[model samples]
Target: MERDFKMTAITMAGLEEVLADELRKLGAQNVKEGIRNVSFKGDKGFMYKANIALRTAIRVLKPIKTSKVFDEEDLYEAIQRIKWERYLDVEGTFAIGAVVNSKNFTTNSHYISLKSKDAIADYFMHKYKKRPNVDLKYPDVKIHIHIHKEWLTISLDSSGDSLHKRGYRSATNIAPINEVLAAGLVMLSGYKGDENFIDPMCGSGTILIEAAMIANNIPANINRKHFAFENWKDYDEDLYFVIQDALLKKITSSHFKIMGFDKAPSAIKKAQQNIINANLEEFIGVHHVNFFNSKKEVFGKTTILFNPPYGERLNINVEEFYRKIGDTLKHNYENSTAWLITSDIQALKYVGLRTSKRVPLKNADLDCRFVKYELYEGSKKMKKQIDIGE
Candidate 1:
């Protein structure tokens, strides 16, 4: 636990590079981006910091073993060879989740999980005359199995439940964005708290909360209830607290405004409550006004990032709504940069303004795009001065 070890951070499909950047900033070594995951080398203290600090990561996995498996028996034998006692005990509880991406394995992933669990149980039974019980909901040890075409990896879920459940948001809207996705969008939009930020269609204030956290340098999971590593046999309470204190001490004041606007009164209320819950009321504000009817309140340069109705969430005229968005940004929100994420790509054509950047992203099961529209000052000639990559 004192030495450097390999760790993998799982993220959204399009956030691998973002997660890698975050890991590198946190002093992780040998950071590499893979498909929906980032692999890095860090000691146990870095592991603790990554769990609490990474904004784009979903879960940090500490791989205990990796091997090539031909069949179910190979998987079981490989898992059994591990010294499970190091991570779990007879009186403790454990759970396993299997992810299978293989043509050779036709069995259900749940069946694979059961087989792996059985292997561990048999190993402990033969060795110590007792076995750990399965506690699916609140397990002391959580194991994740990944089988990518016969290559098997067993990892311990250090960040219990996803890190998306950052514990500050006690309320949620009907179509609220995932917390990790919200934070990732803000990070990808390149807003570093240097300028004023806004979420015109903020549903439950997730983007606003995440933006405030980013600006203030707050640990992403500071409010999280628990992490699997807390219950590990080698858990270091003092080290974890030291890391937390260091991260907390790094928080700096944000001078710029972070605001959100929603047409619905309920959404505004929920957003306010969530902002207050995150202790970010000083930095964020929620308003119950339709974004289309309102002008940019902030005088200086503004960074607007929002997830408007994609015609799927909340009924709206997709074409007309996108048109209005384009009009509002082009006319009222001058000298600003606006970014929006939507699954309705075809509807994007209604927004007449040319997007400077179009990033392909995935939100849950829907294929989405995170697009950026530059709102230049003055006449149309300003568009020529702006660059695509700028």
Candidate 2:
């Protein structure tokens, strides 16, 4: 590969800038942030590194071609014009996912995917005697179509599954945070291998695992079995191994502790299992205890990041729960910076502590707020003045 081909990365909504900053740190060229996506330039090895290291990206795509399409016929013609034989064999199973945003095209994405699949199958059936099968669960080849108005961009999904499948999480209970979001939260918190970290409300240890990975400089996908590049026609195993070895060599030993506390014993068991699965048992410790009654005693300059249960089921008193969060942090965790994410805006007001930062984020489909509070040992007003050099 010439190392100059353009690549696109898709991310969760409102995380395009986050993904773009990550790519820039990885030395990607011509980085541009779009809505829920980032475009950059890299080679085959860079593609592998991006898959292994990126924390916010969902999938990395290599655009094969971009053109204008008016209807299904145009879509088929464009898909067929790209020599599919170069990328996959007639025996390989494949799947297509389409995203449409056009006024004239009211066709469902599933139908568009089916039409594109037919075009590929027909192309192979006409050229060869056999056609590939479609495997939705796991496919050797995955194609993506993006139609915006009249423009169509067809790309190959280099990340077969979503990047959130970091390969370490086998034990999960209710409300396990997404790996990418967890990593992003750690990044946004500005805790870089310094200070003790605690996810006091850790349900399945997702935040703790992500924090340990960041602190130890481990590759995000170190335990992953396969990347989509491994299935690419031009995959260079030796080059990939070289890159992997180099990345592994950079893994530093972490001395800081990452602790998780969950009130439910079942949640603690799942967290411990997940930590062990990630080979990070030494770095992370999980305890079964209610966070509201717990105090910060992790030693110097602790950073707490947690996601408390936002009452969506309408059974729990959300206002009271949030108020408890404020009381616990203010009374117990002095000299600490605590951050929490919740979708309940009404409940957030109950946590009466002044938020130092209010970051707008989304969890699943729910618009959420990621707020930070600075707990002080004495008067918060005096501490604020001291912090501001007043």
Candidate 3:
């Protein structure tokens, strides 16, 4: 029988609760949310499932040890005491990544990573007269060291290359949003594929693909080629296959319409190719139509979610672009809820529409707000009255 152990799922700042809910659904015990991460308890099989199924998590980590240390010597000694031989072999390649938030350490995360690497290498050298080589790109055993004040926690990265690389995007436009963030945006909008979904400014079709997966109960990493747990010393190939098959069997067909629209012909082509790569071409349709010129074409309730340009990566008139978005949503997209994420706080005033909800989020280094606007089937006067009532 597999013994239960604690694990952590790292995510963006605002999606911690969403990740915790996902873990609980997957039968995780002692689920707790923290800053940019969620901690839970599960066995080995559950760890594999989390890697494959979690959409909002960037990576899943299995902590091996935690210790209190004051200086670099203490850090090195603590790392050396962990039985590295169990997780890694003398002939295997390994890498260490560090995150430091301590006033005691004057060095940065890169230097801390280097120091931890030396300690691991020395431990192997002293025991067997030879040490393993370091492979930063594809390590056999990827380790993580995180320091918060005087407490340091060491973990084994179970999901390598980050879970955001879903392996479906062979083509992307400039400043493409991360896959995890795309999924989180879809989930946050409360769209479960029961209603029509549209990405007005879909770039590379990321949101469209993620929405199709959610609607059809598809596993997040079904198309991913590899995971770090497969390289572990005690990896069970048969068990991994069994878990994967179980998740695959849970997939269901979705009939709701999922579509993407982009004014750029290049963006439309990239989105179409990526949709094909994800095997979701049958479920999603991409068109070269500017959203401002298009109206809600699908019937029944619909959800429109997009990551528009905030004048950060793409060149655009921030004020005018946002104002057009408000005009289009109010005049064209009737009986639909529109949600957009942007970093320009001042530009939001030009939108001219009262937001129903606003969520604080971070897009890479920039602080963003994911705001929602509800569009009812009415005239401009009625809409103004509705806004005034709110």
- Give TM-scores for every candidate, taking all chains together and pairing residue i with residue i: 0.97, 0.96, 0.96
lDDT of 1: 0.92
> What is the descending lDDT order?
3, 1, 2
Minimal lDDT window, size 10, model 1: 381-390
Winning candidate number (lDDT): 3
lDDT for each candidate structure: 0.92, 0.89, 0.93
Each candidate's clash count:
0, 0, 0
lDDT of 1 by residue, 1-390 (tens): 279999999999998888889999999999999999999999999999999999998999999999999899999999999999899988999999999998878999999999999999999999999989999999999999999997999999998899999988878888789999999999999999999999999988999999999999998998888999999999999999999999999999989999899998988888888888888999998888899898987889899999988745748777898999999888899989999999999999999999989989999999999999888788656566565433
Clashing pairs in 2: none
**Per-residue accuracy of model 2 over 1-390 as CA lDDT, tens digit each:** 365789999988767888899999988999999988999998888998898888889899999999999988899999889889999899898999999999868988888889989999999998997899999988888899999999999999999999999999998876678998998888888888888999998998999999999999998888889887788788889988988998899899878878999999999998998899999999998998899999988778889999888745336888788899999989999888999988888888899899989898989988988889988888978987998999
lDDT of 3 by residue, 173-244 (tens): 888998999999999999998999999999899999999999999999999999999999989889999999
In TM-score terms, candidate 3 sits at: 0.96
Lowest summed lDDT window (length 10), candidate 2: 310-319
